[model samples]
Target: MEKFTTLTGVAAPLPIVNVDTDMIIPKQFLKTIKRTGLGASLFYEQRFNEDGSENEDFILNKPAYRNAKILVAGDNFGCGSSREHAPWALQDFGITCVISTSFADIFYNNCFKNGILPIVVSPEELEKLMDDASRGSNATLTVDLEAEEIRGPDGGRIPFKIDAFRRHCLLNGLDDIGLTMQKSEAIQGYEGRMSENRPWV
Candidate 1:
């Protein structure tokens, strides 16, 4: 997990609603437990044609958004069965933050664990960002987590809310494993005590 203080990058506009986990990374790709290679399959269905050709009109397939680090999507983003791979694919594809009017609960929680920020904004605010993202080459938004602000290309800022604990996790880059490691010293001490008390076991 990497600390997410602030990010300024290309914002790809995906205005379609109900962008589910399977659409983000088709069900077939879920076989692999490893998280690294899923980037190529992020939005696999919409990105490729029947003959494995890149769909030219899709926002991610466009040249300007090929490296997009932020996504401005429609409502109900990441809706589907609880799959950790959803955020894995997004993070692997270099999307550090996702902005939408709403998100599925499980997917929203998974984002923080995988080092991706899932932001929930009002419908009106999301529409404004969606329009900003329509600019392609000019579509850049600054997400300041510390300040809870999203700055559009025109320098207008929109505020968002997040859970205090989740905010702390992302700010310090502390995933589940990272959080556990923070108590390593105490864990080691406990193990040492157990060894001394139960020599045979």
Candidate 2:
């Protein structure tokens, strides 16, 4: 996982609600456990047509949003299954932060582990973000994790809340493995003591 101290990039507006995990990466792409390369298949069904051509009507296919790093979506974002691949796909696609009214519990927790920031805001705040994102290429929002503020294109700022421990982990680029590694010395000592005391076993 990468450190997520701050990010400023294009914001794509996705107004449809109840966006499930399957809708994000689809089941066919789940066979591979590797996290990389999933970006190309993110939103596979809605992003492509029956003939394998890019769906022009899709928000992600639009030129302005093709490289969007922030997503301003509707309520209940990341709902349904608890697949970790959903966050992997979003992070691989360059989405560092997602602003929505609400998100499924599992998905929200997964985002932090994958280095993606899932922000929960009030309905009124989401409306403001959606309006800002409607600007297309100019829809840039700056997210400062340390300050917990989102600065919009016009200089307006919206504050957000996050768990302190999650914030600490993201700031230090610490995933589960990274967290474990922090106590490697202690773990090594414990193993050595166990071997010395129970060598017969």
Candidate 3:
């Protein structure tokens, strides 16, 4: 996982609601455990046609949003199955931050672990962000985790809240493995003592 202190980039407007995990990376792409290469298949169905041609209508396929790093989406942004691949695909596609009116619990938790920021805002706030994202190439939003503020292209700011522990983990680039490593010395000491006391086992 990477540290996510701050990020400023193009905001892609995905106004559709109930965007499930499968809709994100699709079920076929889930066979591979590797997080890489899923970026190409992110939103596979919506981004491609029946013949595998790029869909011009999808927000991600548009030239302006092709490299978008922020996504302003509708409500229930990550519903359905609890697939970790959804966040992996989003992060692989360069979307470090996602702003939505609401999100599924599992998906929201997975975003932090994968170094992606999933923001929940009021419906009114989402409307504002969506309008800002509609500005084509000029749709830029700055997400400052430390400040808990989202700065829009026109210099407007929207505040958000997140769990303090999750914020700390993201700031320090600490995933579950990283968190465990922080106590390596204590774990090593415990194992040493166990071996000394129970050598017969």
Candidate 4:
């Protein structure tokens, strides 16, 4: 996982609510367990037609949002199945942060593990951000994790709250395995003592 201190880039507006994991990567693309290639298939169903051609109508296919680093979506984003691949696909698609009024619990936590920031904001605040993102190529937003603030293109600032421990982990690039590694010495010592005291086993 990568450290997520701050980010500044274009934000794609996705106002669809109840965006489930399947809608994100689709079931066909889940054949591979690897994370990198999924970006090309992110939102596969919506992004492509039955003939396997690009859909010009989808928000992501638009030239301005093709490289968007942040997403401003509608309420209850990432709902449905608890798939870790949802965040993986988002990260692979170059989305470092997602701002929505609310998110599914499992998907929200998975985002943090995969080095993606999932932000929960008020409905009124989301409207403001969505309006900013509607500017297409000019929809640049800045997210400062340390400061817990989001700055819009016109210099409007919004504050958000997150769990202190999750904030620390994201700042330092610590995942579950990374957290366990922090106590390696203690684990080693315990193993050594067990071996010495139980020689027969």
Cα lDDT over the full model 2: 0.94
Q: Which stretches of candidate 3 lie over 4 Å from their true place?
A: none
2 or 4, which is superior by TM-score? 2
Worst 10 residues of 3 by lDDT: 133-142
**If the candidates were sorted by their lDDT against the true structure, best first, what order would they fall in?**
2, 3, 4, 1
* Tens-digit lDDT track of model 2 for 39-132: 9999999999999999999999999999999999999999999999999999899998999999999999999999999999999999999999
lDDT of 4: 0.93
lDDT tens digits by residue: candidate 3, 1-201:
799999999999999999999999899999999989899999999999999999999999999999999999989999999999999999999998999989999999999999999999999999999999999886688999999999998999999999999999999999999999999999999999999999987
For candidate 1, lDDT tens digit of each residue in 34-98? 98999999988899999999999888999999999999999999998888999999999999999
Worst lDDT window (10 residues) for model 4?
A: 25-34
State the TM-score for model 4: 0.96
Candidate 2's clash total is 0
Cα shift from native, residue 60, model 3 (Å)? 0.6
lDDT of each: 0.93, 0.94, 0.94, 0.93
